[model samples]
Structure formats: structure tokens, C-alpha cells
Target: MKVSLITATYNSEATIEDCMLSVLNQTYPNIEYIIVDGGSNEKTLKYLNEAAEKHSNIILSSEPDQGIYDALNKGIAKATGEIVGFVHSDDFLADPSIISAIVEAFKAQEVDGVYGDLHYVALENTAKIIRNWVSEPFDHRLLRRGWMPAHPTLYVKRDLYKKYGVFDLNYRIAADYDFILRIFKQPNLKFHYLPKTIVKMRVGGASNKSLKNIIQKSKEDYRAIKTNHIGNWLTILLKNVSKLKQFKS
Candidate 1:
């Protein structure tokens, strides 16, 4: 099956090239690499163009966007594969064979979605892994407890978006959490957990980079729990905090 890999970029020249290289060198060949750039002022677009030129499977668009979620929605609109996944411009697959592993998992299990673990690296040294987020199989009870898989490693079927719709524009940074809750926590969707590292992300991203953003993320996450009828507000708050320990491991 073909997998559509979408990346949302904005002045991400520092990490974009590595991200492109990871995908371009993938063992799985039937990939449609699509990039949605937010009209970067830096050299990000030039690198994006260079990568696209080298890989015929790459499709790119650079334009002004509302935010990351908006760019993701746009990428989703252009996706043509049966399975759709996103690899942020600042992130890369953990290895060249990641896509091959994902495809094998999907084909073997016939799952609607598949997700894995993530590693957050320090900006000064990409080789230095700062934190590890090891994900587990989906459990409905975990939703009320504010549990969510790493968004970068998550892959969903294109048809699921057609049925459930795209990311909620209301969320500024927590849209991905909301999207995962809506998809995996809801009824009747089959999800497979790949017990491996799928993506390596740089630290200092928009949502988790600062104390202020962390507070905002908590507030938005609480709102998501409320909107989705997950559980008691206080319990969800505690549940959200519990996720921080995942990084320590």
C-alpha cells in the first residue's frame, strides 16, 4: 500500500534536509512525500525544492498558512494514499527502513492505524537523545486519563479523515491530541502498535519548548478532554501530568 507522508514546514532549513534525506532513502518505495510550507523567509524553501527535484515522488507547496494544523489539513486534502502520515519538517524517521516496517505491520495486521515510539534530541546535538517516549497499545480507558501516542509517529488511513474530518482549527497547539482522542478513543477503529522508534524529533518545538507553551498546552488539553467527554476535569489534569514521566524513561 502507498503511504502519503506530509510535512508542515516554516523556516526549518536546519533540520529539513535531514528529514528529506530520511524519507528519500527509505526502503519502501511507494511513498508520496508531500510538503506544505508556511511561506518561509529562510532557505527552507530552497532545500525543499532541492529535495523535491531529486525525488520524483516528492510533491511540495509553499504558501501562507494559519498554523501547523492548517498546513496539516492542507496536506491531508492533497493526500492520495490509502494510509496518511505526517513527519514534521523538524523531524525525521529513526531509520531508512521505518516505512518498510510500517508497511509490513499494516499488511500483516490489517490495521486502520499504526503508531510507534519517539525520541526527542537536543538541538545542539542530534545524536544526543534527550528524552524517550515509548508508546503502548491503545487502551480506551487511557483517554480519560489523558494518554496519547506520539503524534509524529502516528499514521492514519486517509478514509478515516474523510469520515471523521481534519484537525480542529480551534486548537492552536493541542489539535493533534484532540485528533488522536477522536480517532483512537472512539468506537470501532482497529489500531496497531509498532514497538519501535518511528520518528526522531528535535526539542524546542512550538508546543513543548517553553514553560509558557507548556501551560497553554495543558489548558488546551483540558479543553480537549472536556469537549470529547473523556472524564472528570481534575482527573484528566492529573492524567496529562502523568505523561511527563514518559520522557524520564
Candidate 2:
């Protein structure tokens, strides 16, 4: 199966090369890499220009976008593969075979989606792992407790995004959470847990960059839960509490 990986970048000259190379070097031959750059004046545009010369399937557009979510929507619109996934500018695939394994799982398990674990490494030292987000198989009840697989590890069908819709631009930092909730709540869709680290992301993402962002995230997360009718304030509490174990691990 062809997997379309969408990468949203802006001024990511320092990190986006690794992200792009990770996809370009994937063992899976059928990959449509779409890059949605947010009008970066830095070396980001230059890097993509050189990559475009070497990569025939690299569809790139550099323009100012509303935000990362909006940029992702643009990537989604351009994606033609059966499966859609993301490897953000500050992240890279775990290995060359990760995408191949994801496709194998999709075919063998007959699941609607595939996801694995995520490793958050120190931005200053990508080799030094700061946190591990190990995820389990899909269970609808888990959503009520605010449990969700790592966003970067997720790969869903393109049609599902069309059916359920893309990220709500209203959510500044919690759109991934809201999007996952919207998908998981459905009874029809199914997912397979690949049980391995699929993506390695750098630390200090926009959502958790500061205390103010954390507070904002908490509020947005609560709104997502309440708006989705998955649970109330208690769900947020459990969701926050669940992270303790991940840190401990």
C-alpha cells in the first residue's frame, strides 16, 4: 500500500532534513512525501529546493499558513496514498523498515489504522531519550480516561480523514487530541498496535514548551473532552495523571 507522509514545516532548517531523509530512505517504495512549508525564509526553503531536485515525488509548497494544523490540512488535500501519516519537521522515523512494518500490520490484521510507540528525545541531543510514550491496543473505553496513542505514530486511511474531517483549526495546541477523540469514538474503525517505537521526536514541542502553554493545553483538552462528550473534568484529571506512569517508565 502507498503511504503518504505529510510534513508541516516552518523555519525548520535545523531539523527538517532528518525528517525528510527519514521518509525518503524508507524501505517502502511507494511513498508520496508532501511538504507544506509555512513560508520559511530560512534555510528550510533551500533544503527543500535541493531535495526536490533529487526526489521526483516531493510535492512542496512554501507559503504563509494560519498554523501547523492549517498547513497539515493543505498536505492532506494533496495526499494521494491510501494511508496518511505525519512525520513533523522535528521528528524522524525510528528506522527504514518502520513504514514497511506498518503496511504489513495493516494487511495482516485488517485494521483501519496502525500506530506504535513514540520516543521524545532531548532537542539538544537527539540520541538521548527523554521520555517514552508506550501505547497499547485500541480500546474505546480508554478514550474516556483520556488515553490516546502518540499522534506521530498514527497512520490512518485517507478516506477516514475525509469522512471524519481534519483537525479543527480552532484548537491551537490540542487539535491532535481532539482529532484522535473524534476518530476513536467511532465504532466502525479499528486499529493495530505495532508494539514498537515508530517515531522519535525532539523535545520542546509547541504544546508543552512552557507553563502558559501547558495551562492552555489543559483548558483546550478539557474543552475537547467536554465537546466530544467523552467525559467531564475528571477525564482531564485522569489524562494528566496517566502521564505519570509514562514518565516513570
Candidate 3:
């Protein structure tokens, strides 16, 4: 199956090369790498241009965007592959074979989506372990407990987006959580949990960059829970508490 991997970047010169290299070196040959750059600096664009020049499969677009979610929505619209997934600018695949394994899972289980574990490593030293987000198999009941798979590790059929819709821009930081709840809550859809680390994300993402952002994310998360009829304030509380275990691991 053809998998479309999208990466949204902005002024990411420091980590853009590693992110691009990881995708370019994927074992899966049938991947359409789409990059939606948010008018990055000259240095970042230089790297993007150089990589696009050598990789025939890469489709690059550089322009102003509202935020990461907006850039991702643009990528989704441009994607023409059987499956769609994301690799943020500050993140990279755990290994070249990760995409290959995801494709295999899609075919083997005949599921609508597949997700795996994630590791949040130190920004300066990716080898330095920080937090491990090991996910579990899908169960609608788990949503009540604020359980969710790592967003970067999720790969779903493109058609699901067409049916359920894209990210809600109203959510500044909790858009991924809102989108996940929208899709995973569907009764007929099936998702498989691949018991492997798929992506290694760098710490200090926008959602957790500051105390204010954290507070805003909590508010948006609670709104998503209420909007989706998943749970209440307690659900949001559980969600925050659950992250403690990731740090312990």
C-alpha cells in the first residue's frame, strides 16, 4: 500500500535534516513524502530544497500557515496515498523499518488504523530517554479513562478523514486529542496496536512549551471530552495523571 507521510515544519533547521533523513531512509518504497513548511527561515528552506532535489517522491510546499494543525490539514488534502500519517518536524521514525511494519499491520489485520508506542527523548540528545508512551489495544471504554495512542504513531486509511473530517482549528493545542476521539469512537471502525516504538519525539513541543499553554490545553481537552460525549472534568484529570507513568517508564 502507498503510505503518505506528512511533516509540518517551521524554522526547524536544527532538526529538519534528521526528520527528512529518517523518512527518506524508510524501508517502504511506496511512500509519498509531503512536507508542508510554514515559511521557514532561509537555512531551513535550504535543507528542504536540497532534500527535495534528491528525493523524487517528496512534494514540498512552503507558505504561511495558522499553526501545525493547519499545515497538517493542507498535507492531508494533498495526500493521494492509501494511508496517511504524520512525522512532526522535531520528531523522527524510530527506525527505517517502522513504516514497513505499519503497512504490514494494515494488511495483516485489515484494520482501519494502526498505532504504536512513542518515546519522548531529550531535545539535545535523542538517545537520552525521557518518557515512554506505550499504548494499549483499542477499547471504546478506555476513552473514558483518557486513554489515547500516540498521535505521531497513528496511521489510518485516508478515507477515514474524508468521512469523519479533519482537525478542528478551534483547539489550539488539543486538536490531536479531539481528532483522535472523533475517529476512535466510531463503533464500526477497527484499530490495531502494534507493540513497537514507532516514533521518537523531541521534548518541548508547543502544547507543553509553557505554563499558559498547558493550562489552555487542559481547557481544550476538557471541551473535547464534553463535545465528543466521552467523559467530563474527571476524564481530563485522568489524562494529565496518566502522563506520570510515561515519565516513570
Regions of candidate 2 where Cα sits further than 4 Å from its true position: none
Cα lDDT tens digits, model 1, 82-181, are: 8899989888899999998998898899989999999999786888888888989988887777678899999888999998889999999999988888
Against the true structure, candidate 2 has what lDDT?
A: 0.93
Residue 211, candidate 1: Cα error in Å is 1.7
lDDT of 3 by residue, 148-242 (tens): 99999999999999999999999999999999999999999999999999999999998888999999999999999999999998898899999
lDDT (0 to 1) per candidate: 0.88, 0.93, 0.95
* Backbone N/Cα/C clashes per model: 0, 0, 0
Residue 62, model 2, lDDT: 92
Residue 60's C-alpha lDDT in candidate 2? Answer: 93
Candidate order (TM-score): 3, 2, 1
Off by over 4 Å in 3: none
Candidate 1 residue pairs in backbone clash: none
Models 1 onward score TM values of 0.96, 0.98, 0.98
Model 2 per-residue lDDT tens digits across residues 1-249: 889999999999999988999999998999999999999988999999899889998999999999999999999999999999999999999999999999999999998899999999989888888888999988999988889899999999999889999999999999999999998899999998999999999989998899999999999999999878898888889988887776633
Query: TM-score for model 3?
Result: 0.98
